[model samples]
Target chain A: MLGDALSLSLGYNATLVTLGATLLGAAAGMAGTFLYLRKNALISDAISHATLPGLGIAFLIAVAFGWDGRQLAILLGGSALSAALGLYFVNWLTRETRLTQDTAIGCILSVSFAFGVVLFTIIQVLPAGRKAGLESFLLGSTAGMLYSDALLILVLSIITALVLVVFLRPIKLVTFDASYSETLGISVRRVDFIILTLTLAVTVLGMKIVGLILIVALLIIPAVSARFWSEKTDIILITSTAFGALSGYIGSAISAVSAGLPTGPIIVLCAFGFFLISFLFAPKRGVLAVALKHYQFQKTVHLTQGLLSLALRQSIYEPKTRRLLQRFGYIRADGVVTEVGKSLAAKTLLNEKRWSYWQETLRESDQFDGQVVFSLMDIETKLTQDQILLIDQGLAARKGKKL
Target chain B: MMSGIALVSDKGVLLNAAADDRNAPFTIRGLTVSYGQVPAVYSIDFTAPAGSLIGILGPNGAGKSTLLKAAMGIVPVVSGQVSFFGKPLKEARYQVAYVPQRASVDWDFPATVYDVVLMGLYPILGLLRRVSKADKAKVAESLAKVGMQDFADRQIGQLSGGQQQRVFLARALTQRADVFLLDEPFSGVDAATETAIISVLKILQLEGKTVIAVHHDLSTVSTYFDHLFLLNRKAVAYGSVTKVFTKDNLVTAYGGKLGAAQLDAIGL
Candidate 1:
């Protein structure tokens, strides 16, 4: 697509558009980070849904004025109004009533969007000889974007980014602890207003490409993936923008060149791809990685448990007696031992795995050298195997208690 | 001054009746904090001498945390004057370090323990002064004092509750402030965490700092603090533990017949 766009001599415009889209996505990522942190991801979604009415109104004004007159101004103004109203209701429902934030967000989204649809329908009730260019604003289409839209998005994105940076420390402090931030001389009201205002500005600007219904995906997906990539504030912010930019470029190219595909879903899916990769491959917190770690941990524990049980057998058993005892339960007569038997392996393998299972109990007991100085009775006043293990694991069960 | 002292769980054990410094670090007149139409705190009065560990004690809704917040200038005081070293909080912003409640923040926020501790330098490093090597050293020193030097680079969310609390204390230490306001710092903490924070505060107190903490669980109030401020919608008592933390004062602070909440004993 880049090659084709380049060959046609429209390369510069294409690059500019991609750059503009990337900038838009970056602002979305930055704004979305706070939304994710504040547990207000759905707030953006609600704002997006509510902006549809603003679109129809802006279209009416644009048509009355002429398409070339002041479309950006009217569009931004309408979306901003819708977004503010959405925010007011979100705050009202969540604060004034006992309704959960999720419920409030959903109610605002559905009702406001339905209103937008009704307004669009009323305006076009008679098919008033004019094209329904206003309806196109509902789902968004890049066909209408020109260099002017790019410039507007750029200005809005810069302002939004600046806001995020200036209030970075306060925002960080509050996201970590709002009540404490209030205690430390920070105003929750001002911070919340800043966040919401930034969200509104970003939404109005991005409504060109992703439209009102799907701009939220552009806002939220990057931050959600960022959670999996880094645990540091600065890194999370940076990574969110980078990933967001990547999705923006990919979504734009696909929508522009593909035969048919909704740009909104494409951008969201691109972001979801990033999220999926992070969730699966992220070093420690990733879903599959954590699960794999757990599996390894459990396997080691079982090996250790088996070794310990073997140790409980008489020393007279030496090596063969242990194997004979093992054969009683795990060995196969076909001379091909079971997988568990193979997993148990030699003493070396069992010993290697032993720490996985035994670490917890021995840690509780504060035991070293396989020699537990404190007996279960001495440590916890009971002789249960679980208690002994807990004691060995150095947990509260036996931490301060005298054996 | 005692050797191998076990950290007091509440304001009671750590505060000695004699720990009061002749130089009081703060004074508040008619301090009040309100949330919109609701009054989280209404009219608080108190003074703390420098180098003293004071506990602000009350029941769940006694506005203990709110009082501390008002003093810190974090909570808006609908009407009142607070003086730190005889100046307003804005003039003395760098001199105050605030350690918030453990549960008030999102622990899963992407920040290293080191990065979090460095936030304490924000008042000093405000505007465009880059966080210098000196600031990094202070963060390390604070983390080390909290026995969290080894975990400095670890993500805050990955830590246990006690560790996260210590990290917050580390940040406070980096503020290098003359006073500290901790909201429910000891809540949900283990013995080690209690000890760690007490030790850090000791270093601060030795340097003649004033430590005011909003603490629940009244059992340890007498033992933990040199002074006590018992507040429930108003100033109930403010003075030395012996003078203001008496049995009668306990009843008064715990809303002794004021509000419906009775003094519930929780081991300090």
Candidate 2:
């Protein structure tokens, strides 16, 4: 198994393709961090989809000059041009037309994608268009990548990463708060334009590796997954880039081993896998960790309530209640209620009584719903019938009457 | 003498610093701000003294925040000029700090209190320069001032509203600016946090920093500020608290609905 893995990695074309994909992933992920934090993650999708027409038009222009239309530089330039135009269009629509940002992005995304589809159809029937091999970009065919294609991707990725490092401070501030950054003497518009241009560059270069349709996954998945692991922006940026590179390398390798599978879908699937793992397993922010903390909180609330009830009934906790409270660290081994336990009981009782009073008051006004109260509490344990009845009586007696 | 420090003229005067060396610490001339042609702050003029706490008191929708934003150049001005230390905003940037409203930022953003505080050092460090050990030490010192040294590494989202306000105050302190403009700093803060912030503001005032805040609670205005700017789209009154915090000023600012008893009851 070791030999097989080594041989697969050492294959000349496989190594180049994987290296190129990995670089593209890291670059996209770095740029994606700013976009994600600024709440504009979908802007990448809009830009990527917008690049399709650029690729088609570039091919047509190259063919008109009797040159190979698939030249890497020319194609990527066209993609970048159209992506910039799409960005400007979205900006204009949102600013000048009173359309919401989501609406602007959606309009550009759908319109540009549909126009590209039309251009693709038109290219197919042209005399030399049948040989353009532009279809490979739709669902990236990594096997078709020449050494120069991989080299182009590698160069762009290096440039992008360098730019990000040089401008890290301003980018960090702008992402956190643009208006506040302005007060620090930073030009918010200039920083925003720089970030958008960098994102466009990454998206244009990434289209060949992940395909325009799925490149957004490479951008957003890693950034969001990184959020589950760290709370610092620098740490999140580094972790996200690492996750992106890992996804690219592993996804490309898997596709290389399996014939007839496309690289783009495999890469996106790999990113999705990482996101799922982070969502479920990451500490502090993950689903499982939050569920555990919530469960512990509920149990503490129950134990505190039980202690309060016992204290009220007999001026002491019942033996069973005391043992439960002790096990939960609400009481000391000497059978005395600890300070923390006493405060917890008092706090819980206060909140319960407050909510009960509100419920009773609302009921007298013909506006109460027990289910609404339960749902608002949002606890897993159902309140027994007797407990509800007791709250009702307590609330009524507090109102100068008994139920 | 600090090369960039603005000096107050002896005549309680606002000088054009290019002609005379003495400069007012903060001044706004004919400042008007609007949202898409609808005016928010209209033709306001004021010259604030150095080393004083000023409260911007106004009713809701009175453009208190808009004035602050316009001063910071965050919002576009219809026609106005804002000067700090007798210089343009960009030139005086390092000497001035603006603490935005607490609700303006996403607390869930992936940053710890320390990380946010360190952002104060960015403008001083300028572009492409990494923060040094000295910067980190300064951040810790600022956190200590706000009684939040123990929470330096805590994620900002986990903090209570008052704790979050303290963290922001610490961030502003880290900037070490001579002038501060805070927007609604005490709106949602607990009494303890409010007192703590007020004490810190007092210390800054003692150190000769000009602090202006958008304040909502009329009851605390007299104790919090030495001067007051009562505003409603226009400057209704601007002077020392003792002279400006009057029943007539309150009525004008609140559209003539507030009574003298109401002002007296609030300790005005």
For every prediction, compared with the true complex, DockQ reads 0.29, 0.34
Query: Candidate 1's residue-wise lDDT over A1-403, tens digit each?
Result: 6445323334555555566677888889998998888888888888888887777777676666666323667777887887788889898998878799899998999998888888778777635414566655666666657888888888878898888888888888777677655545677788888898888888877777777777888888898888887777778888888888888777766665664676656777888899899988999789988999887665544444444453443132244434553554444544344556544444433333334334544443212222332221123242456744544455433445765
In CAPRI terms, model 2 is classed as acceptable
* Model 1: per-residue Cα lDDT over B170-226, one tens digit each: 888887888898888889977677777877777777776788888775667766777
lDDT of each: 0.71, 0.81
Minimum summed lDDT over a 10-residue window in model 1 chain A is located at A369-378
DockQ of model 1 vs. true complex: 0.29
Model 2 Cα lDDT, one tens digit per residue, A17-98: 7888888888878888888988889988889988989999999999899998978789888988998999999999988887
Regions of model 1 farther than 4 Å from truth = A1-19, A62-70, A92-107, A126-129, A158-167, A179-191, A314-403, B1-24, B31-42, B76-80, B217-219, B232-236, B251-268
Best candidate, DockQ: 2
Worst 10 residues of 2 chain B by lDDT: B8-17
